[model samples]
Target: MDIINEILSSNILPYVLLGYAISILVVVIMIVLENRNPLKTISWVLVLLLLPGLGFILYIFFGQNFRKEKIIARKGLRNHHRLNNLAYSQISQLTHGSLGDNETARQPTGIVRLLLNNSSSLVTTGNEVTFLNNGKDKFEALLRELKNARHFIHLEYYIFAEDRIGNEVKKILKEKASRGVEVRLIVDDVGSWELKRSFFEEMRNAGVEVYSFLQVRFPLLTSKVNYRNHRKIVVIDGHIGFIGGYNIADRYKEGDAKTYGIWRDTHIMIQGDAVNSLQSIFLTDWYFVSRTELTDPKYFPASQPVSNKVMQIVPSGPDSDWPAIMMGIFHTITSARDYLYIATPYFLPSESVLFALKTAALSGVDVRIIIPEKSDAFITLLCSRSYIREMLEAGVQIYFYQKGFLHAKTVVADDKISIVGSANMDFRSFEQNFEATAFIYDKGAAQEMKATFFKDQSDSEIILLPEWIDRPYIEKVKESFARLFSPLL
Candidate 1:
């Protein structure tokens, strides 16, 4: 009784009450000010009311910025006029299937169609894709391309770790900068939190234009923590580009993952007109981060004949109201005629995605999903298991990669279309973080991607329904709880 009385007398309750009230007020103001969907607004309101203190904190960090208007404005300025008529004509052809129609070949309805109509891009195609499986292979190709860069090199990634691979790439960038090559690199401050700022500073000192995306600092202030740029792209001389799930970290290399050993991820080296899409994506993001309109004529010169493969680059994030990447996956999976192959490190999908996969499997599609038997995040792995149970019952073959962590995110459908990029099959990537991907419509590329998936499946153990259900009750409970927060995860 004496301790209770002392605690009450200490005035902690009053301070706590004051803080809670402030948070609630802020959350309400942000929701209303941002003009979010009524359904989503109610969902957020429930979170704030239920969790109280923690909910408000999450809202302050993530809820305030749904659309990055200021960032988009800067991006708009960078390439507002370049490639005007021809680009618009291409966009119309890709979207509407005709020069005058406004519908896209991939998505003909909803927000994506609207985005295509408003932001008419040059629907460039004809590119070749090469799968970079191992870190050594990826590093070698990256170095070779960087060394051959003549005009400029634009690079962006979530994590740029400072290990052997990172340092090697860093040294090249430094050397290239010294040679008067216009080098620009952007890294997410939080994703690369472990990477010492000194590494970036060294690059800056060596003449590389470096910028950090949404640097997080302090405890209770700032809303930059939730908005992360998770796009990995490399454009050299505006002639070739690489986009994929890999990052600049030794952790992705063999003998580098001391715990897992073989790190698996997929990257594509694109050649031809499709490079323009990647270039535009970089310019938009660069303008947002650096606040400088980057329109050096040498970088985005003109589209020339490089390859005969058809490809489309898709970029999505919080800036756009529609969940572009997630919707794209859903559309592709639902449209599969014969086979659907998917590889992802994480599988925490939204309700719509879950439905799409199940529908495809039940509709007689030979659906298959490959995921890491063991993951860096145990909670996510467990949640992924829960989804697999449903998919298995729906006739989807689920494989647990026995080799090591499978971080590659590649989707091949019907041996005609393929999609690959940094976006994972999860809620965070689908709706929250910024992501980029490439859609390919080439027989050669699709066949090669399918072959690689089959190779990995040979070493993977298929997950049986009985085996998944027979797991411990405690594990099931954890998954159920994790699933309940799918929207916010």
Candidate 2:
């Protein structure tokens, strides 16, 4: 009784009560605002209620408006008329009979169509695709193409380290720019944060035009924390283009000086009409980043036949009201006739995606998934493991790549459809973050992608049901806890 009296008499009571009151108030407000999804709202509220101090920090940093409006406003204004009626005409000609139904039809439904319509073009058929497997081959091809530049070169990437590969590429751009090549380079301020201003200064001094995408400045009116341009695109002479799970860094091509051997990644180098789509994407992004009105005829001059590759570029981010890439995935899985193969490093899929894959597998479609045996993020890996049990039980074949981390995001289905891009199969890429992908309807490309997927699968270790069940008790417990926070992951 004396101890209890002393505790009540102490100053801790007031402070504890004050903290409790404030926390409860914030949680209550969050619940009310996010109440439309009762299950999700309750889950988040429980997290906030249980973790106390740290939960508030997580919610503020990650849960709230991570996508700023001013950025959206700028993008909307810059790209307002780009997706007009003329774009539809191009898509109509590109798709032709596939607009209804053909061997390789693109059915971009719902908000995806709206986003496509906004982009001024729907998914076109007949995209010729060349898949570059290693950085050496990729860089060699890029250099060869860039050297042939006649008009302009627009390059954008999330990571552009000033290492060996980057320096070599910079040298080419500088040489071209000095010869009046109209080179425009845009790098993500956050991802390529380490590129010394001096490196850019050299390129600028050599006549290359450069800009940083979404450079977060403090004392800015909007939420200074949200939004990142995580796209990797390169357009050379407005005829050849590249985009995918590749970046401009020595660590990717030939690895860092310390780490030997090349880092395995997939990048697509496309030619023909497809490059125009990439060029449009660059123009819009450049406009938003620099706020400079640019309409140079050389940047997008009247085109003649350069090559014979048919391709469609898919871009997505927060500005749109709908999740564009997610919709594309949903359509692809739903429409799969024979087989569905997915390879991603991260697989924290939304509920709909989880259902689609599971349903596809259960319905006797050969559903297979490949994920890295190890990942860059440990917690996300656990979250991925949490999905394995149910999926395996449903007859979905899960392969853990044993050779090394499988970072490429590719999906090939039944020799008809193929998707390759930087968008990982996760909640963040699907709904929150910026991403781009290419949907290739060419049979030859689909076959090539499928062949490569199987080749990697040979080196993978398929998880057996018994082995999964016999996983250490601690692992099961960890996955359970990790699964709880999946919505927020």
Candidate 3:
């Protein structure tokens, strides 16, 4: 008892106590001043209280809110207000003119208006959209487009692996740069951290301008680590563009045979005025990183209408005050009069999205969601299962793809509206990552997406409510525990 007393009263105890007190103080400050979601606040507090020393370190890296400061800086650099004014002017002209005459625009007007107003995503008419179902097709088409590049090539992705496919793409990029094509590439530092500086030296030596978004010097001590650039965009000479869930990696290609089997995904190739919007998004991000303004008319060359497909390139990120992509999806679900089909790798949605989906299902709308049977993140899978019962009970049909891992983020509503992008049906995509989706107002595009969803469904196993409820008790407990971390996940 004497020894215990002495140890408890040792000088080391005071330093330990001080450390814990500082952690507690930080927790209090976060709860009081961060203005985060109540659930997230509780989650962070719980992590801090439970993990003690390590929790505070995690909080320092992930919990600090630098969005407002970074957003203000980006706004000042990009002149966002001028872009907003231009978008608003375009919206006014479209609203008063013959935009409603097109059936594609007549439907989903509210969603279009909301994106235009909130995200400054101007609706562009006359776009041709082609769906690429897998990475094989996507990369093939991308390579062809790269081979034909003339003036400039811009590419951005969350993951640009230094693997087989990545090397091939790099070879093409180097060749293009060598031919005076002005190639530029941006990748997320954290996602592609495996890539060494030497991996990019060859490209740099060949005149390719490479930059990493929000590079982390110290991975465990940086606030920027939480926010990632998740968008995958490819623009060839400002006339052709590709955007969707694909990254430059062999794992995305079919026959790569990952642990989950074949990889299934979706991407879209765009030609016409919509490519200009995609290029603008790339330029905005480019300016943020490279600090070289690219507002010349050469990059925004006039595009003649190729098709009747109306498109709005809606970009969302932590930089924005509102979750624009989530809001657009919510509006799409609420406005659906016939049916809604969704395919995403992650299904952990926000409360508003969950409410919207449940409301839509209960309103007699045919709502269906497809998720992969085996996800890359096991914790996210566990948390996703926690919501399966609720969604099933609400009459929302849930299907788990069995043929392969489904990484496509797609939605087709009422056979007249479609969305394809990098933003998943999850809070991380909505609230943290820089994502972009193409709001396509065309029955042809919607039908193609719906057909793809059905094709994916042919290989999926539907989860019945009774069977989901009868899952093992241990699994239920695991799900409950995982759900507690859903906000943070």
Candidate 4:
């Protein structure tokens, strides 16, 4: 008590307090200068002022704009030189309508040009895309492809658990690597941190080269922790590829034992020229991780177009200069003449996306969105619900999936555009984490995606405006509180 009193009453206390205030002011000034999302900036300011101690720590970890560092810029620009000519030539062809097959392609060719100019996301045709509805089907297909990987296997995932499914996949990777198939894996350091190093070591012993994306060591955890590589990509021999929301974990295959019934998810098994793009994305990340570029002709083997499916494997993140997927979705929504259906686990959309949805709905475009009734995160669920009232007011139909957690990040715009990938319609997906989505411009594929959406819709319960407005005040309070963190979520 005497020591505490002496410290509290010390003559230097005033100087120390002044220094602390100055420091906080300095941080606030930095946040303002960073020019972050206005909402995020305001949230950070409030946190620092209201809870200085905790907020400062949180700011130190997440609020810092790592984009200014230019490492991600370098990573993003690596493909520019190579893709520039291809993009330019394609843009030239696309502008004249020689690139597309039919009038159905006329509408979304704008999106193709946008992606081409923005992200070098080339439009590849004759790619066959098969939707893997759940994790079980995804894995079965993935394993089958893994077994047939004759040349090389490249995989990048946010989560690669050390469970039954992980072991099974690892076993195949080991077997392939042993046969000189050149297997490589990138698991997000933080996402897969639960497993012991030995888990990966076992694969290493079997000759599989494994590395982590944005490895977060003890004290250097900040900054990187906020920007994750959330993409789930698997390229086998540059001919067969897989991309979607399912990470390598048991819960995705078997139902979430702790949460509820089947953990419903969506993935795509792609076979065509699009595989080259998928391969390129994996190699780019692999180069970032291993510093060894795999640009051999074997890595991107020549693939004959398997079908008439036209698509672009769009990639985006902090590494990207522009929010490609977000912008693309905005354009897609605005261009929708008929109806647009979406399925995503998280729906904390950026301002542009939210505006796009509301505007599209208001403009008489039938916009239907399906999200999990009870998401894995309670706070996230409430945060998602907070946007519902505004959406419902705009006449956008919102449905809650009661069967299970619907973790499919998909957007089907009219009969010409079908988007599916690892990206959720959220700030984390658009602004922070690395994501890759295939924007398919095809009638057959779009129709198939619509059919899938309708099937899921049948199982979902729609929210009417009256019922949503009449919800209990306590629930609204929880959602209101959660909404404050939407930008950071």
What TM-score against the true fold does each predicted structure earn? 0.87, 0.87, 0.95, 0.96
lDDT of 1: 0.78
- Between candidates 1 and 4, name the one with more favorable TM-score: 4
lDDT of 4 by residue, 384-430 (tens): 99999999999899999988889999999879899999999988888
Task: Evaluate model 4: give its lDDT.
Answer: 0.87
Assess each prediction's global lDDT (C-alpha) against the native: 0.78, 0.75, 0.87, 0.87
Better of 2 and 4 by lDDT: 4
Stretches of model 3 off by over 4 angstroms after superposition? 1-15, 76-82, 94-107, 219-221, 255-258
User: Over 4 Å off in model 2, which ranges?
Assistant: 1-20, 31-43, 66-70, 74-80, 87-121, 219-226, 255-262, 304-310
Choose 2 or 4, whichever is better by TM-score. 4
Per residue, candidate 3 scores C-alpha lDDT tens digits across 262-304 of: 8999999999888988887888889878888776768878887
What ranges in model 4 sit over 4 Å off?
1-6, 73-80, 100-107
Residue 266 lDDT (model 3): 93
Kindly give the stretch of ten consecutive residues in candidate 4 with the minimal lDDT sum: 70-79
Per-residue alpha-carbon lDDT of candidate 1 for residues 1-489, written as tens digits (9 for 90 to 100): 988687678978788678778869776877877775454576677778888678876777766654655334532464755644555555555455554322224433332343344343344544566788877788789989999987789999999988888888989999999999989999998889887767778889999999888778877335567778999999998987999988998787653355665888889888887787788888878888887877777667676556666656777886664667777788788788799999998988777788889999899999999999988887787778778788888999999998878999889988877889999998789877888988776677889999999999997999888988999999889887666555565
TM-score of candidate 2 versus the correct structure, residues matched by position: 0.87
Output the worst ten-in-a-row residue range by lDDT, candidate 2. Answer: 103-112
